[model samples]
Target: MINVDNLSYSFPQKDLYNKVSFTLEEGQHAAFIGASGNGKSTLIDIIMDPERYMFDGKLEIDPNCKIGYVSQFSQLDKTKEITVFEYIAEEFIKLQNEIANICTQMETSSDIETLLEKYQEALDAFDAIDGDDFESNINKKLNLANLNKHKDRMISELSGGEFKLIQVIKEMLNNPDLMIMDEPDVFLDFENLNSLKNLINSHKKTMLVITHNRYLLNHCFNKIIHLENMEIQEFDGRYIDYNFSLLQTKIELQELAIADDEEIARNEIRIEKLRERATYNAEASNGRALKARVKIQERLEARRIKAPFVDIKQPNINLANNNEIEETIALKVEDFSVAFDEVLLENVNFEIKSTDKVALIGINGVGKTTLLREIFKNNNDCIKINNDIEVAYLSQMQDEILNESNTILQEFYDAGFETYREIRRYLSNYGFGEDRIEQKIESLSGGEKNILQLAKVSASKANMLLLDEPTSHLDTYSQIALEKAIQNYNGAILMISHDYHFIVNCMDYVLMIEDKTIRKVSMKKFRKMIYAKHFDKDYLEIEQKKKSVETQIALALMDTDFERAKILSQELEALIKSL
Candidate 1:
């Protein structure tokens, strides 16, 4: 169990948390959610180590409880030349070494009895910690991820997605009592994401997850802790439930504030009338009536309630609507192939209509981003676009487009606004006040950069938009607003995103890149097809058989039975060939 009381933190610019408190019971899973720059990640850091952040709070953790943490941007050290299996079984190897050392001491010690006792103790510790099952656990996780073939591969050679999966597998091997995962869904494909979900659900340990994936939050977490306006609100349900309840609470508070304001206004009017009468009779009266009226006003002031919380206004994204198109095809690709160190995509063919809204989706390391960049390059005849059509591309690294040295006002001006007043008015439409307009771009948070990019794109006169992972850093409300804006856009849109909710709501057609080919399908049909593939009997059977062989091989290797491992390897090869 973990408990926090009256936690507060401050930075140079703003206070992140103020008098926040919450408790997580043992074995409970919860999610922390809020807008970007509202300190969700900072709160996690404080909980992990309050003293490190110098936060003012009271935190309590159960003694001797182990924690496993997976950060959003964790990367493998390229200098460390270690195999995937060795990395995952590191703790078990340490325990084995300790036991071996104790046994070697027992061989020639003068105090044989004490040495024997120590050896036995070491063995018991190993068993108590489930060290014997480490190999099996590692193999099981790898096989579930269809990564058992790479068990002996160097960690430094793995792709970003593979490295992330290895880290998650290592954490699972630790069998920690508490697990904290931040943005674990970033590089995962749909199949791997489901694998991760199953892995998380199978473990009963307490978990705290921070993710922008609505599917994960709604399916995995039972409780929510929302951080807003330097305050925290706890809800005893999933994301959908919490959202509904929050909306209801906001409505009630708004009504109450309106009623209180009307009452205060009426009391003020009465007070003014009483003072006027007193002033008219000043010559004949002693001013007792005026004093009484002043006292009544004071009483009324004491009864005034605090106002309701109003959310910061989201930026108004207004995409240009261009209905005129001389050509029917906005974009077309034929026999498109791209290769770097290895072949990523091959023989892909697709086309986009003038007013089509299409989504490009594929597994991690399958070249979704590469394809977008290739299209933008337009180096060959394989890709074609309409003549004289303007295209606006928003890369995954969209934040890098901003000039750090320039102020927001200057940036807007650089985007082609003529006068300061015009730029100011445009910025205001995106929720930027005078103070924010003067702030430098370097000081802006990730979410703020995203909003600025959106504003720029929306203000562009381009007839075709290419967006790559555009919603990754946006808040929930901003994402919804963007979806609406995209829906209202009259031009063609071709976007690459892993956000399922955003894709389903914004796109009508799907362009799935797999097996070196591009297949065009409806979004609904694509979802059903993926679901069917996940539950196919033959696929499940093959996966189970491979998992069994992999587990056996791992156990044999752990026990130093090389002959047995060789035989199991043959069996694995045969199974693969049969599949």
Candidate 2:
């Protein structure tokens, strides 16, 4: 838990926030949403005390906490090039060193060897709790996000989406009591996004998430903190509730602004008159009159001009100009297969249309991304469409589009924007301001870079948006905002995300890609399939057996009898449940 009181932080512009007071409780999930450059990141940094930003008031963190922060990206030294296993194992080594120091302090005899063994066990136990399910957890999450099949590969070799997976995997392993995740969903596909949201739901710790992803805010967060008008305010609702309410508030603010100006004028005239009267009788003013004069001065100074709230809306992209029916296809595939030494999947087929707003859906490692790429490649004649469809790709891992040497604005410019004004306008839509546009893209977090990449694509004037897991790092509000933007987009959208809410909200059709195959289903039908899949007879039967047997085996593990351990182990061979 942490508390800030009467907090005011400043930059060269207006106060990022002023006189703000709030508390983040131990078990609450706080989501921060704002138009770009309203100081969401600055607030987070201030909370974390990263930049040593000046504070006007107080920030108090719980004394009994080791806060685990998952930054938007992994910024390891490139020279290391570690594997996932190695990366996680190193944490245990650190734990080992800590235990050694503790044992050294508690030393009593030459039996220190025994202490070493005990400390080793303790450290091992520490890692095992998180590492036990880590293999399956990472693989399941990666496959869902389309980042599997590369787990054994060096971290440096991972694509943008893949690195995002690494970042998530590392964070999940920490098991922090207080998790500060920035754009935790940036690189996940729909199933992985769903898995991520569920994982966040299961966590029993406090979370402060900064994202623009609407789907996350809608379901995962219990509180919404909107940054507007140089102050922070909390809304008790989901992302959708807060956003629409915010939109209405923006309208109301404009009316308030009009009324505020008139009030200010009247107050100024009153103060002038009061000052004139006080000036005439300065030497003989009594207590009541002096008090009245002081009160008038305070009232005149208190009426600060707060800017009316403005919605950080999306760009109005126009691509629908077709007057004739071009019953052609955009992508064709036949016997499109991909495999490792072991076959993940093979022999896929699908077609895309310029008019379709489709979602790529599948469980992790079902080859969803592979299928999308295959569809884009040429295979056979059954698929018919215009070959000239310009695709705007927003990869789940923004590293693909992000260049360290390039500033955020430079990346857009490099994407072939003709002018500076165009670049600024595009960045603004993604919540970036003029100050942020010039910041290095690589310096930006995974989520910030992602927004920039999306802005680049939108500014590129592309008609077919080939989005591969764009919801990974976005906060819940941003997710829905994007969903709304996509819904309004006339261009064809081929998006791959694992957020169920996202897929359900923005997509009109579904593309189920698994085992190197592709099948197009209606959104309604896909939902039905998901429901039936969960409540099937086979699953229900196994689930019922698990509940009854798990308790008995756990009890056996607690017993000292050799026969009981053997018998219980035989009766329930699997200790960990699949679900």
Candidate 2 Cα RMSD (Å): 14.9
Q: Count the backbone clashes (under 3 Å) in each candidate.
A: 0, 36
The 0-to-1 C-alpha lDDT of every candidate, in the order given, reads 0.75, 0.63
Model 1's alpha-carbon lDDT is 0.75
**Candidate 1: which pairs clash?**
none
Give per-residue CA lDDT, model 1, range 277-381, as digits (tens): 877777445377667767876876787665545544366787774545764888899988988656877888899988899999887667887888777777778
Could you estimate the TM-score for every candidate?
0.76, 0.65
Top-scoring candidate (lDDT): 1
Worst 10 residues of 1 by lDDT: 534-543
lDDT of 2 at 501: 57
Model 2 worst lDDT run, 10 consecutive residues: 316-325
